[model samples]
Target chain A: MSAISIQQIVKTFPGKHSVVALDHVDLLVESGELFGIIGPDGAGKTTLFRIIATLLLADEGTATLRGMDVVRDYKKIRKVIGYMPGKFSLYQDLTVEENIQFFATLFLTSLEENYDLIKDIYVQLEPFKDRKAGKLSGGMKQKLALCCALIHRPDVLLLDEPTTGVDPVSRKEFWEMLGRLKTSGMTIVVSTPYMDEAVLCDRIALMQTGKILQTDTPQGIIDSYALQLLAIGGDHLYDTLQLLRHFEGTANCFAFGDKLHLSLKDNSYSAASVTAYLEKNGRTDTTVEPIQPGIEDCFMAYL
Target chain B: MRVLLFLLVKEFQQIFRNPAIIRIIFIMPAVQLLVLPLAADYEVKNVYITVVDNDHSSYSHALVNKLVASDYFVLTGYADSYAQAMLDIEQDRSDLIIEIPGQFERTLVREDKATVSIAANAVNGAKGGIGASYAASLIQDFNTDIRTDWLQLPRYNPYPVIAITGSNWYNLHMRYDLFMVPGILVILLTMVGSFLASINIVYEKEVGTIEQINVSPIRKYQFILGKLIPFWIIGFVVLTIGLVISRVAYGIIPEGSFGLIYLFAAVYLLAFLGIGLLLSTYADTQQQAMFISFFLMMIFILMGGLYTSIDSMPEWAQVIAHLNPVTYFIEVMRMVVMKGSTFADIRSQFFIISGMAVFFNVWAVLNYRKRN
Candidate 1:
């Protein structure tokens, strides 16, 4: 059974200059799968999460979770979905325990009923239970927010950039926790701008400018890049890029970190011939080698 | 219902966890109820006066002496001329100025009526009226005394239609403190409950907590009720404290049924909390909510007959006062406390408050968005 099925979803904000936040976006998540939406800022990842969480209505699409429509069955949908927003949005003035209890009671449950699910996270906050939420550290606040979201034992979890401002160590810990949550057969849909985190997800959708460019396994997307790639770097990186653009057998030349990845227009040019040609042009110490494509390489290729 | 209880508990924890906000929510209301009533009084006393005795005669001196003898006026200093007296008035050193024209006793004996010019500061119209009346009465008494003994004229009471009938109601002693204490209590409750509740919710919206709650399983009505019930109870508790202090310190107590008063108070508190929720739906920041609530509170209290009787206002203002909830609350409170009114007597006010509560709560729920 599909945990979440979104078909041709479209959302637009109205004003003098209307913004089309999402455009014909379609996605499907199998039951008990951890799916990630990988995109930069303003890539409509947050909009899609909000719609699936039943907090917003789409303009021209139908989205269902476990055969329940997001709009018509919002009350029932709210009971089974845990949503952590991009920002830390708990009551700042209330204590950590108080915020948790408030949200627990909001779902007609108690702390004792959900203690097992949140015990690991809540124990870290127990020492500072009496302290105001505003006085907590960033990582501790993130944990508290997660506890509040998961207090009801939700069947599906939707997190919008949960690790945006957290530290590196905390980000690693958060992903480990998500891995543990996946073992319990909870379907999770997470959005992130970090490309490194994309490897942890079972599947990911690479989005850009309100459109999904590709949706596949991390390895699958990397393997699908069809180009003859070569990394060229020397003393003159910018001049090498200009020289490569003018080269007779070059299709596309773009910089990637210390080296530039260049695609060939046709497979006629040899590596030694290109190197000797650069040396004759007073460009020495230049190295040329074929390289395997990664996700970042694939991203640059599409751009 | 269970969610409402949780929200109320959370609100209490939020308020109690911060000492500064606790002081503001609890102690400030007590101070306003106990201390501010004494400080804010309209009854003028010990008004400073400057006298310009231009006549330099016994009659002029005696008139100045009489004016100074009255407890209402204090002779601050003697001015050299009317211009100096006017200067004193402008400088706020004196509230009243007395100028005695050069009229010896012989002139009053011959002319039968001597003129005395008095200038009063009319910026505060009530103080000016009282000062002018007191001065005029003193002069009239002096004229009567002269006519009876020194002039050797017929023993007659000049301006003899002196009919004195005094009446007092609600507050028999007409203590300014009694009149002001309840009004200040009303203002304090309005600030702490309605204004504070609205501002608190708006602050959540500004900081993005409302979005969090929107995504949760909490219904819109449950969330609003949760935010409101806690503040409503706090407002009631604060009002009770104010009442106890008024009774202990000022010896004031309600002569009517306590249950009836609380019923009215509960309805009134619901109206106020509803208003706070409505304001929260319209505002996006704590500062905007506070400013708007303060503005509305000022308008309501001013028209509430807390400071002045609304009946004395113009027809238009009186009509507006009927729409103000504070006005009806103050009226009901005074009636029950001072006149021993019952629920039947205040049923009209009760209906108005209930109507306002229902109307505002429904409007607030409608305006409050689950998605934004």
Candidate 2:
């Protein structure tokens, strides 16, 4: 059985006119996979996470974790799942040791009991145990939050945008820590708006506007791209982008770094035809190459 | 129980760690309790009087001396005419005008009858009413003395009569502080209890920490009790400190059972704190909770019978006072402190407050859900 399975879950927020926050969403995470739910803001990602964590009720259909019904087995699920919300929410006035100890004791466990589970992260936090959680740097606060969530040694962890606002170095360290945890055989589900982090997950579900656009392994998602993509590099990248958009067979074209990635309406269009067309249009020193799709390319294709 | 213990430890740490909150909860109430009672006195005193003695007789002068000696009135001046006395009162110079008529001593000795007109500035009605009564009683005492001296004549017969006496119970000197301080302390305690409890949960909700607790295995009642218990203990500590100050500053002590007074206070705090928590649940921000608490606090304190006697209130207002938990505590304080009342004496108040405690706390707990 899947560790977490969801089917046709629907959620709406009441307002002047009701807002459908989640429209017929479905997801499944196997026993021990680092699954990423990739979406921009307002995509049913948070709504889905909240439902699976038993913090909210779906307006329709059902979801379960380890074969326990979410609605009926809420108490049991609360014991098994660790949830870290999007914001830095640990008590600002509390010292780091106190916050971790509080969450540990809340789960009817002690810090000493889970020392092995959180010791690596706590090593960085140990020296500053007396400092208030709010007084810590952004990276330290992020680590402390992760430690508190993990103190109970939960079987499944749900992290909502954990590294949304952190230095690049800290974000790298955070992901490395998650990688270690996954290797130790704990199932984790994380959500982020950054498309680059999709490759870090074992599997990913791309979501937009309350709908799941696609779900697959990161490599599979890139390989499944149906459009013939070409990266054309030359002088004046912006000018090349506008020139490519005016091409008769161009389906979509956008600037990517120093080049413009262009896809055609027909896969039969030759790369030499594109090079000849660019040279005729006063472009110089142009290099054209067929490229395999990245996750962002796949996401843009789906859009 | 273990979960509750840890939550309590966390709560107490947060509460004590903020030096501003500690100062607000600890130092401010004690100082206000010490100083507010003396400043909030409402006893009738120093009634300024202008004597308009038209006759200028020995009897009139004697009555004026008696009024001055009673210490209730200060004779500011003897007006030459009633118009002068009216001007004095209108100008806020005097509160009462005692006008001695022309017949003065002649009518009293010959006809055994006389009349005097006393005009009072009734803008401050309590002072006016009290001052007029004091002057009337003193003049009557002087008349009786004159009759006694007249009876010393050889053939005069002593009249058989009845005299009435009164005793002021609970407060013999009618010290307003003894009555007011306990009531004000109840207001202060209620303000502290409800304000702190109201802000507690909303603060967590605003900071997003409540979402963490919401997803935990902590029971709903455990979470609420964990939040309220810290403030519940603080409320009692505040009361104990207030009571000690009441004793040291005003020489006031509970005349009834000390155990009974504390029992009533505990129940009262429970009711106010529960309402505060209920407000917190309905508010998404601390500012919203503060406004809602302020709105409720206004109604609770005004209808609480702290300053005015409930018995004197309008029929509807008195009916509303029955619903206020603060009213019961204030009444219990007076009954226990001044009247030396026992449990049986305040049995009705006890039952009502116990019912309020159960109603408010159960309502608060029931509305508090672990899920959004």
The TM-score leader among the candidates is 1
- Segments of candidate 1 deviating more than 4 angstroms: A92-101, A110-136, A234-255, A263-282, B150-161
Please write out the lDDT profile of model 2 over residues B85-120, one tens digit for every residue: 999999999999999988788888789989988888
For model 2, what is the alpha-carbon lDDT of residue A230? 94
RMSD of each: 2.9, 3.7
**CAPRI tier for the interface of model 2:** medium
Cα-based lDDT at residue B182, candidate 2: 83
* Global lDDT scores for all candidate models: 0.85, 0.88
* lDDT of candidate model 2 versus the reference: 0.88
Q: Chain A TM-score of each model, in the order shown?
A: 0.91, 0.95
* Regions more than 4 Å wrong, model 2: A230-248, A255-261, A268-292, B46-164
Query: Model 1 over residues A1-303: C-alpha lDDT tens digits?
Result: 899999999999899999998999989998898999999899899899899988889999999998899999988898899999998999888888878888888788988998988887888899999888989988888888889989999999998998898899988988888898889889988999988899899998998877888999999988888777888987789998888788887767899879988877666775766777678777888899988877777776667
Error of 1 at B285 (Å): 2.2
